[model samples]
Target: MQRWLTYQKERFPLLAHFPLVLLTSWCVLSFASPEPVKIGTLLLVTLLILGLFFQLRVFDEFKDYEEDKTYRPYRAVPRGLITLRELRNVGLFVAGFQLTATYSWNYPSLTLLLVCWIYMVLMGKEFFNPEWLKKQPLLYMLSHLPIVALIQMYAASFVWDLDFPPATWVLALVSLSGGALLEYGRKIRPPEKEEHGVQTYSALWGIPRALMTWFLAGSFGVFALGFAGGGWWVLSVFYGLMFPYALISALRKSALWLKFVELFSAIWIVLMYLALARFP
Candidate 1:
């Protein structure tokens, strides 16, 4: 039990993720329904989203086991803090809980959950061609990013009919862009910090280009929020304030600044969801 708690702190960090998951679930529920969200529904949806992210982390551990073992031995799974078998058992338990919870609380959403599971299974397998996909980093990231959108759609399903209007997909786009922003931001590193066998956007695309891609991904999310009739001005103001600093940091190749950028990516997503919840 102690080891599992340690593993979560080192790997998942529920303290960092819970609020974001709750806000994201609330945003989707707000956008999908005109009615006020019951506390029961909000709690169930937040747990479901949290469980989904935890399962994704578990899948990543399994998928990247060999790579992490070789290049990142300090990680929890690599350092013997937790065994893969134990993690797999926990993941299975979470999956079962997600299924049963959705079935009991919102049966219609079960289909959407299954769809997300199917896509996640494909992602875990790297679409069955890991070698080819690895060679195309952009494609690999793009392929996996849809999982974020699908998760958002599933959240929406809790409050919306399966046949929701086309406009609702804009929220999915916002979610996808948020995922992209985080993916690009976290993988960026100063040139000096690049590690062999570790795939970082900064290493692959150079610091400037990688920063540009991250910025553009974030800009896309802001535009998506505006198009969806959310309070995009809030994000736009935040973006205007942050970009120059991020650009200067990247140009200076400050590792500390890179960490700031990574942190900002998470904050940006939370704010984006908050803005969405403002939808009239």
Candidate 2:
């Protein structure tokens, strides 16, 4: 048992936990507001989503095996801590099991599960195709937007059964811009001399240029969130909280953007919950 726990920790890492926490909380909050659903049903959805979530990590290890060896040797697959066969087996088992459990939920729940699966597959492709899409930076960012929107939509409407409120849109936009910040930060990786396979933003374009593009994209995110209609103070507080992170990012010291955005994203979610409580 101890060995299995350690393996999962190595395979998924702490960063993996953030997405699961955000997603699961979104689902549970859905159950909480407007009207509460049966605890049993909510529990089932949580378990299923969380299960698939972990399994997706396993698949990432399998897909990025070589890249991990060269660039991210600490990662589970390249480090030889876990085998490709084991990853595939575990991913399939978890996905099948999670879907089977979620099948008992309403049709919308099952559909949401299916949508999540398709997203996992597509995201894997996106990571591999980053270079191909870099020609159109805006299009590249636009392509990734739906993934965030889907998560927000599932949490806001499908699970919560709440109307698409201004607050939910704020959350979705925050999630998108937060993610873009990561893409922007990737532009800062020191340039490599030799030809490389890694299709990162920095790899395709030199760090300075990438950072400029990313900052512009982030500016758009801030503007969108700022203009989005909602409670003035709540929105102000949310955007204000993000500014420090952006400020730190502008200093161009290191990859602090992710740290800031992660903090910002978490705070954004909390603000959303507060808005939900006060407004609805």
Candidate 3:
């Protein structure tokens, strides 16, 4: 139990993820339907989103096992803090629970849920072309990032009829941009912190270029949120503040600021969704 707790702390901090997922699930449902979201339904959808995220984390653990063992031996699995078999069982259990719950709650959602699972499985296998994909970091990131949008679509299934009109898809676009922003934010490390085999945007594209990409992603997110009826002033201000901080941090090569950038990415997503929920 203690080991599992430590693993969750290191790999997936619940305190940070729960509210973000909850808000994400809520905003999707709220955006889909004008009616007030029921508490029970909101909680169920949040559970589903949380399970999907954890399942993906487990998939990453399995897929990256070798590289992690060789280049990142201090991680939970390589350090022997947890076994792959144990993580596999947990993943299976979560998958089963998600499948069962979705089937019981809304049979129509099951199809979309299965589709999301298929995409996730493909991601876990790196689309069976790990060599080619690894050589193309941009494509690799784009392929995996759509899962965030798919998860949002699945959440919308609870409130929407699944027709997924243009307006509905704009919400997915917001999610995709958020995923990109978070992906770039977390991977933009200082030069001193770059690992030999680890692939970071900073290492691949250099700091200035990586920061530009991150900024563009955040810009797209703001546009999508505005299109989806989100409040813009607050989001714009927050983005303006974070960009300079990111520049200063990258310039000084401050590891602490890089961590802040990651945390700010989460905050940005949460704020975007919150803005949608409020203005809707």
Candidate 4:
């Protein structure tokens, strides 16, 4: 058990928790709002989704084993912390549990089951065939948008049973742009080290160009989210605050700054929801 715990920590990392937190919070918030829905089943469904999410990480660790050896040596798979067979078993178990859990919830859970399965499939493709979608920086950046948007969409649908508002579409676009910018920023890291095995957007586009793309993408995201909530002036200002920090991170050549950008980006969605809750 201790060894398994260590493997999970090394392979999945805390970064994996962010999506679960965001999705669960959105689900709860949607339920609390003007059009409340039954959440008793939703909570259990979310737990199953999160469990599947972790299991998929194990699959990802195995799938990216080769690439990780070259570029991410610290990753658990290559470090010999876990075995491929173990990951396979875990993945199968999680998949089965996810399906069973969703089926128990009702039609809404069924829809979520399909969406989650697609996300897992995409992750496999992204990790294995970087050549297929990941090779194209723009397309790679766009890849995550659907998954993020689907989180909110699932929550809105489950809670309100209403078609997702236009604002949700705007939020999805914002997520897409931010994802693109971050990928673009990473592409330029240590520009001289292009010989490294990993092919990145910055490697293809160069630093200056990547920075331009990142800035434009970030700018559009802020504006998109800002207006999405109907100009709750304070939240709009908060959204704009992310740009300066991203710029500083650019100037200093620091990936840590990118973490800040991600944090702020996530907070924008939460704030947008809160700002909207003030009305109706």
Candidate 5:
């Protein structure tokens, strides 16, 4: 049990995931209500989202098992620290916990949960055509990212009592863009560090192009946040200056700089949600 707990903490890093999960739920819930949400509602959504993310991680482990064995055998699962059976059991437990929590909400909210739950299952299987999406990275990413929007919408549904409004699309788009930015950032590794069978964005699209796409996604995130009437200006200027510098540094092929850029992209998402919670 201790070993499994350690593995989960190392993979998910609660320091980062908890803040982002809590704020993400708060940000979306705030979109439905001008004032603060109830403590019970806020915590329930946070737990559901966190469990969903954990399942996503478990899905990745199963999906990438063979690939990880070939490209990065030292990883926890690839190195035999834990088996897929164990991980799948954990994933099922988390999903059950999420369902139990959602049962406390209204029936309409359960429908919203079902939407996300179904979407997540499809994502885990890569829509039943892994090879097809592996050949189309952008489409693959776009397909997978809507879950972020769906989960955000699910959070909003609880606040609005099943009468969630279309205005919440702004929050959805913000979540999508922020997710895309982080997705792009992590997959943008330098060429030398790139391992065979690892389909990094840097390898798929040249380093410069990948960096440009990441920055573009971040810009869209800024626009979405500002459009949602949240504190977006701080992020706009922050990313506007930060991205170009990160791009230039990435061009110089500094691995350290690229990693820092990844960290910064995560912080950008965290801060945006924090600001939304505090000011929205």
Candidate 6:
């Protein structure tokens, strides 16, 4: 049991992860509902989001089991800290719980949950061509990241009380950019951490370009928040003060950026949603 928990923390890190997921869900609540969000709705949606994130991590495990065994034997799964079969069973269990919780309150909520589930399954399959898609960074990232938007929609529906419109769907992009911030930033590892087969943005685009990409993505995230009129003061100000340093770090691969890189993504996300909830 302890080993399984440790395995999850290695990938998911609940303490660092929960607040960000909760706040993102809260932001969606604020966006979709002007009235006070029901406490029950908040609890359910937050749990669902967290569960789905874990499920996503498990999918990565399943998808990469063989790769880890070959090139990344030190990883938890490959090292036998946990087994592929165990993670698969847990993934199925989490998905089942997600489905059950989605419908327990409102049956219609199942629609969005299923949408997310189906997308997750397709993602697990890597759209049937993992190797080919891995070569295409643009397509690979764009394909996988839309799940963030889907999760946002699911969160909004918990409080929307009306049919979701396609027009308002663009608002989800604000948070989508938040996801990008994490995606790019997390993959920007240092020289020693870079793996041969693993695709780090820094490896693909080179360090300077990768950091530039992170900076730009962070800028767009703030822009999206500001454009949507959600006051992400911390995000705005952090980006404001760190813009120069972020560039320097990217350009120089300095210790400042490396130290900040690990937590910066989570901080941006937490502040982003806090701003949404504050403004909403």
> Could you say which candidate leads in lDDT?
1
Worst 10 residues of 3 by lDDT: 227-236
User: Model 1: how far is 105 from its true place, Å?
Assistant: 0.7
Q: Model 2: per-residue lDDT, tens digit, 4-107?
A: 56777776554665554545454435424566545665555555545655766665676667677887776656776667887788778887776666554444
Per-residue error for 44 in candidate 2, Å, reads 3.2
Each model's lDDT comes to 0.86, 0.56, 0.85, 0.58, 0.78, 0.77
lDDT of 2 at 233: 54
Q: Worst ten-residue run, lDDT, model 2?
A: 186-195
As a TM-score, model 4 comes out at: 0.72
| Candidate 5: segments with Cα more than 4 A from true spot | 228-232, 278-280
Top TM-score: which candidate number?
A: 1
Pairs that clash in candidate 5: none
lDDT of 3 by residue, 220-242 (tens): 87777676666676665766787
Q: Candidate 1 overall Cα lDDT vs. reference? A: 0.86
Candidate 1 residue runs with Cα over 4 Å from true position: none
Error of 3 at 66 (Å): 0.6
Task: Count clashing residue pairs per candidate.
Answer: 0, 0, 0, 1, 0, 0
C-alpha RMSD of each candidate structure in angstroms:
1.4, 5.0, 1.7, 4.3, 2.1, 2.2
TM-score of 5: 0.91
Query: Which residue pairs does candidate 3 place in steric collision?
Result: none
Model 2: clashing residue pairs? Answer: none
Sort the candidates on lDDT, descending order: 1, 3, 5, 6, 4, 2
TM-score of model 2 (CA atoms): 0.67
How would you encode candidate 4's per-residue C-alpha lDDT over 216-253 as one tens digit per residue? Answer: 76566556645655435644455367556556656765
